[model samples]
Target: MNYDHWGRFLAQKVNEHTGLDILKWKNEKKHTWEALSWPDFYDKVNKTALALLDLGVKSGDNVAIWAENMPQWLVADMAVFSIRAVTVPLYANSPEVQAEYILHETESRIVFVGENEQYTKINAIREKLPSLKQVIVFAEPESPEEPDMSFETFVSAGSFANKAEELEKRRRDASMEDLATIIYTSGTTGVPKGVMLTHANFAETLRTHEILLDMNPGDTSIAFLPMSHIFERGWIYMCLNRGMTIYFNHDPREIQTTLAEVRPTFMCTVPRFWEKVYGAVNENINNGPAIKKKIFNWALKVGDSYYMNHKRVKKEPGVMLKLQHAVANAIVYSKVKKKAGLENAKFFPCAGAAIAPEVATFFHRMGIHLMIGYGLSETTATVTVNRYYDFNLASIGKAMPDLEVKVGENNEIMVKGKTVMKGYYKKPIETAEVFDGEWFKTGDAGYFGEDGNLVMTERIKELYKTATGKYVAPNYIEAKLAMDKYIEQIAVFGDRKKYIIALIAPSVQAIKEYAQKMNIAYDNLEELLSHSGIISFFEDRLQKIQREFARFEQIKKFKLLPYPFTVETGELTSTLKLRRKIIFEKYKELIEGMYVD
Candidate 1:
């Protein structure tokens, strides 16, 4: 079915199968579940679409949405799709400069701003957006100072019944080939380019998800990742189509607490969140008395043995393996899963980047099905995923049904499927270079294992040649560094150097513990990062990490960056992928300092 049909189909399912409790926002202390049914959802979408149309939004016009994860954002998105308009979702935390570029490039006619912060951002660059005609804010207007219309005002201006009929009529004509979204690549090198995605692109991805994961109507999902990302966007639609109720996360800071309260059956997250959980667990173990620490360590060893012997190898467990696993799960693994708020989670999909194998194994040992997958935004967010039944911890899994995946001469992954993007918007030459006749060059280097699982090595473009003609894949080195509980972020550099070097960002919790143990006093993050003793500590840690790597891939020199890379900064993309080019340019001075004798 087409993308338009997917939305209508989901809406029909929600109306038939679900009661009023299809979607909820319990975090706000507002019980909105009973009041908002599928009919209500569809009505709002239709009215909102008509409101946008009334504001002169055309069928192909770009309508940008800058908001946190909220019900209104979903409504706005569906409304855009209803009229065959393209939705351009900007990261809520994006800088005004970056947001301005997206808005201007897409030539968005209407922008739905979440609250005051979002409105202020658009207002700052309103003059620069020639095609931007109206600003519809989701928050209630408190005073005359606010320069936007509230969501209530925007919807109230249109006839709900009339708009619903009008949109339903248009929906019948909306084709699978119609452009659904224009997601701007986070622009690691130059200005972000819009990647055009058709309705069929997303629909095909959702179908693949259904095959890989046994998604059903009874399952529930917690939306945590930014909806602006194609990963979450596709997943959200997948849930909607399958008749699953979605709980929108109101505050990311309280995600753990919220997860415990909601107890969702499914979730999607990046590796960093799991890494932080691992860091916390390790820190607690380190702080505990000797006996407790020893027991915890023993339990982990037992758990690892059980996973390797049984799950990884798919062998029948011997008597001793069974005994050890039972003891470990009861004593340690079960407790760990509970603390991580994943006891109720069936299978959590890990994407956006390569998960450290150790962490993946650790979670699997603890009975958490951490399904790791690999894809780019251009691939409609998913290309390969480990099936729930036949998952392998070491592999990213086999290609999805209907997707053609092959490794090139240099082991670069290439994909051809209905889900593959149309091309980069308005840049035919650039698009032509990347998108071959049918297959899209993933730029990611990987190989298909004997078992037919896709194992990603590194990005072909990210690989750098050293002065000695040795090729270094930074991701491989960085993944090893990430296995360290204290190391949060590490970037390797050796483009024209004799030896490799790195910039490290230590975990905040790890740094705090180090400061406490050493009796080092600090006023803030800046002072702690600049401390000579702390720097030496990281140096020693890096040396230890280097020992685990080959000679060429070892990091020879390094510096500790004061702050971690964030989406707010231009260093990282919306999907939490590093923009290496931007980072190298931004930190040229500090990077050069490491090379000087």
Candidate 2:
């Protein structure tokens, strides 16, 4: 894959796919889809690059973007790339201290924010960040003042093309080695370290994905995941490289509606998103009439035979089977898919954590392509992803083209690839510790299967040892139990303890429906969870889910919390991975009580 300047590359794509809608967003007031053509996107990006130049943003300088997914956010990112500057993205909901730490660490000259909420957070800590000079707000603020101007104003200042030559020169002199982004890892412990990625890293990744994935120029994708995370950021870069129309989902709460409206051909999401979908579908199926259940089950069986048995193996189904599939799709599968807003889904990549095999199978059976993959922030998003037809629900599939993957000492999954990060920004000692020669130590324990597919066993650091000398992989247990409809989040703990125990945040709405059906009495959430019926119900569900686990690995006891773990509560990272140590510390008392014999 040859590297080219982002400006030139985007211009080429625009010329090739002229009049195509490259960017889209829903106008809340107008209640319609607003679009930007490829030419419009190219024009906006160029103007934004000039605007950054007008603000004295020089090459190699770091610019912070503290905003949610929006058309302007991508515009800013491309502009930063065109100017040969580094983009340091902070999660839109980043707490004040963490946001301040990144700005101060990067010595960012300017930060672009989304709405007033993000602007307010930056405002409160701007005084503490001496290097931060200007704030460009994407949305109009209640009171726009000095040093804090609207994004429109920032773009208009460049409309005169005052710094056009400077922007052009910067793009002309752009190098593949130039820092593309400094992504801060949302660590489970210790301070976040910035993973430095270069244009070469992104270029190689795009090339590999283009070779492996079958996406086309006219395909449509929805951007819902926070772009600060490498998974979404890298995927979006590839989406644009393919000239796909991207719908920016500004409000995550409206994703379901947006999905229905857009009927996107492609999107990327974490396992948690699918877990909710699985739980909800099961809930609806279970609550329906007897005939409905019968039809749904038969359709799924036919779908499994057609998709998994015949289609996946490249075997043509018989005439009877083909007829059954068509009937199933018409009466059952189509309605279910249309209701879930995935009727038009072509390929949906799921990553960040392990997805339940059942969940993956369910989506596949319904003809919603859920491609499960594995990687970390240091790996530039995907090291391996399940292929279109030949995929195993039990494995994360083979490594990307031209990438090396091997299991080293201690069963650590090591990767050597052009897509890997340059290094952790300014953390030489930390970076040195993670690498052994040319291979990057992924810190994940996995081994290549007989079929040459990688099956991740556990995060080496997350293994828990009990007092009885039994070691447990928390992620394994958690992923298995997360399939239950009642569990929203869980943290397994047993290190140096007598037995495995857990802190569970049950699905409140599901439980409420359960309560109503079971005729349970309760006035509030606290009372409902404490009811003996609810307790017994959870115990039964947990036991059923962990039936295959060994005695030592099974969770012996658990404490249910009234609320779910969240980013705001410091229990989960921005990517929705559990901060186990933080969760353990916060629930120490409850965890200790569960271990009492």
Candidate 3:
């Protein structure tokens, strides 16, 4: 392994440990899984790097990748870094205008796309882009498209044999100061800003999270989230640095099936994935026959108690209980684990949003380690994660070894560490505003718990004041409300209006079971959701859940959405946090209707 740069050198060492496949992907057409060994991966990256050099992509140039999680995406990103170029990643769900703005703003000379879907977006704005020189697509073209070449042609066309010396020189010249990536924020408010992170920023994160990084050669993970997002990108890189095989999921909707097939040891994702899993579990238990329901509940109750006690004090259950647990595991809990692909999973990392403590505990109770942490794009990845056997569900965990975190004014979590970014790219004024001298203001409001773990409260900007001057932290309530299995997704609205209200997306499957049990008639989702029976059920549940809150904190009224909030619909970020303004504006009338006389 060569210590050429603060980053790539470490990956070289782990890749040499095992000669197994570095990347594994499914061929949808062939109905088979395909893999790229390290040698094959290196060869591809070499060709891609040469191809970029051939196309006049000089050192330190900005190149963007507009694609999902795929082998080509990783190859292109590596190829860019090999020549000390900055890799800009555009979200696959980004609209044409947003993509156009990012490409134009970054002044990227070259861009790589996945297929026709991305090609169409670029083609629409190609004429408007002056800095963009070429469009290289991965998949074969369906139609006669100008100014485009297939991924194969782009690689084979490069002549790199004679320029080996030049490539080597570029690699040797890379330093910690070199910009590695410029990730744009998933803007829930205004325009998205590009966060410029250096190689050192990334390297520090990998080294700091070294405990979780002890993945063996047999460890595998599914890259299902947007690789463009720093959270997923950093986790995938960690897998590579630990000699773990990576399985790429092209379509995130099939992540469940993919998980079952791969039986991955680790997966880093947002809280929404687990929330859905919890909802499904509840649905199954609620819908099963009376005896089956009783068995499932008994198993879960025993498992939960065993794990909680085990984790807290490292104690073992008594023989009688142990035998019962074994029987329950064989009868019910084993099925639960295998169904969600956690049967072989050693652990999981969930971040990018505040995960409800109940959800985190639910997994821990079932013997799956769900490490819910906190991070932002600016920090490059994870800032804090629950570690060891002590599953502290309330806190995001103690800060990483070298990082320093403090509660600044308004309870903002202030940070000063190596992992913080150089600053937002080309936005000096905004960057300066976010920092109080050396400490970067995280904008998240929280205080350190008595146990010294960081308890993330909510986004400071999301703390709203009502017309009557009663302040409410929506995320605090939202996090608690998300724990209910019947609630799929919810947006707690009532900023300057009156008392609290909510925009709810109920768990359709769970609601279906409820309807069946209660003998409520419904044909479609719209009918089920509109029925008075289910509405009253949710209303009663909401009241009970918010019983601990102040009078003003309780949700007064709510609107039930027939569909779930998604990134494509501009209601959720890639990590599943609510896009507040978009949801508010989109459903402005519904919110107003709730307050009508």
Candidate 4:
């Protein structure tokens, strides 16, 4: 229960308590699940930490970890924290320049490279990293060439007995005030600022959830999201504290299949995945024969009606409602949930951005307990999360217990609590600007509903003023546009222009289907995207959604991109958030062409 005692806490679970499984993973050979009885887990962590200490990695020194969601990454993370060294996680998908920026900013002494690609990235920028001393590559001897020492060699160099002694010494010196990790924010600004999270900061946040959610050691978690984000970091630590088993996903592409195999009790995800599930279901229904499509449509209507009226009034559903609801659940919803690998899902929390209220309602209607939370990295992860018992479709639930949240004079959500970070790392002026007295300004505009639930409107910084002096929130418009299955990514422009325009990326799968229906042949994706008929189809849909927005906020002109924004392209953040400035700069010419006379 004492989250501050992370070192002793994990050690106790590993040594004394042996019933609970700790971590699980699958490889080419077989699936492996390690219980608390496994001394190998503890041994690797201790030896790794001791090896770092032997290599001159000291308390307060930053240890950079560049890896995907693998067991070694978790081991390195725990070891770094155990040694009282600050852990800095670099997104595995990060560009070489971004990786260099993080390394230089963190002043990391030793780096842990996941594999060949990570090693290659570091090698490209190693010369520019003044503080970096050594790179410990995690791969087999047969693996591709890498920098410095191999992980096995580094651990082998340290005596296990000596490592145990060093771990004890580090634990004795560790305190609540010591910096735990520096999670860099994935922002549009070229320079990523590290959010310094102290041991007490994460400890209190995890403990708050532990009490609120009743998390236990018997619980299991499937971690797919990159651990570089504070959301996953906090969740992983919470799992560790509770002695829950964590299954590291092997193939991200096979997430659904992996979930079916693991059957994890709980997980967290962004709303985009949920949207994809919805789109897939819709596609299946559309592809079916006339009778099946009609049946599917009827079932959806029944489900929607039941969801809308369930708690309010017990209407004896007419024969139609009864028959339609049964058929829908049996044929559509059941198969959809099964395919989503949520057959045994206990709790699912959706965050990072606002989900469509209809999407939230749809899942809830299907007996899915999906809770929505709202927060940013500066808040250390979660400020407000919808409680399981007191759920609402339109609201982002109430604030977490012990956290203070209020709307500022300008409608910005300001929060002050143990969960808040220790200001931005090394940016005193910028930090002071956002911090008002005691509360940390969220920079998001929102208000509390009558039910005391937080209702987020838009980002204060993202709001744009039109030529007519009207303020418009692009996110609201963008969310509406994204609800159309054909639309993948849209950035609503027109900050000071006459009206809003947009940069849109259509879903390739959806576009290809449209092409097939129209009998328009295409050789490849590029030709498909360039087809005028396909572009016009999207334009019509854009106009239809434009009616829902205010006149000033309507997207007037738009440009369709050939490809969707991705992490590799440096257009989207690791969390799948758009880098507005980067996108605008990258497509400057295209954007100008849209407004040309």
- The candidate that wins on lDDT is 2
TM-score of candidate 1 against the unseen true structure = 0.93
Best by TM-score: 2
Local distance difference test values of all predictions, in order: 0.80, 0.88, 0.84, 0.80
Candidate 4 residue lDDT tens string, 1-597: 556545555686676436656777776555554433336777788888888777778888999999888888878887888888988999888889889988998899898888788888888899899998888887652344444777888788748565567779889888988888888888766578888888889878877786446467677788878888788777887777667788887556778877887777777788877877777777677878989888766666677676556522345567766676777889877776787778677678789888888888777666566778987788878899887655666878788889999999779999999989897878888889889888899888899998888999889988889889999988788877787788899987888878788988988777887899999998988788778898788778888867867788888788888888888888998777888888889998988787787
Q: Order of candidates by lDDT, top first?
A: 2, 3, 1, 4
List TM-scores for all candidates, in order.
0.93, 0.97, 0.93, 0.92
Pairs of residues at least 3 apart in sequence or in different chains that clash in candidate 2: none
lDDT, candidate 1, 1-597, per-residue tens: 343454355566656655544566653556433235677787777788788766766677898989998888898999888887899999888889999988888888788888888877787798898987778888874452444689988899657454556666667787888898998887866788899998888777766676745666767788899899888888888778777778888668879977877777888888888877876787788989999899888887777777655666676778987898888888888788787677788888889887877778777767778878888889998889887555777889988888899987688799998888999988998899886678799888888888899999888888889999999989778877886877888888899788898888887887898799999999988899889998888778788867867788888788777789887777887666678887898899999888888
For candidate 2, report its TM-score.
Answer: 0.97
For residue 569, model 2's alpha carbon misses the true position, in angstroms, by 2.2
Q: What is the Å distance of residue 267 in model 1 from its true position?
A: 0.6
Name every residue pair that clashes in candidate 4: none
Worst 10 residues of 3 by lDDT: 1-10
Off by over 4 Å in 2: 1-3, 158-160
Which segments of candidate 3 are over 4 A away from where they belong? 1-11, 289-291, 316-321, 483-486, 507-531, 563-569
Candidate 3 clashing pairs, residues 3+ apart or interchain: none
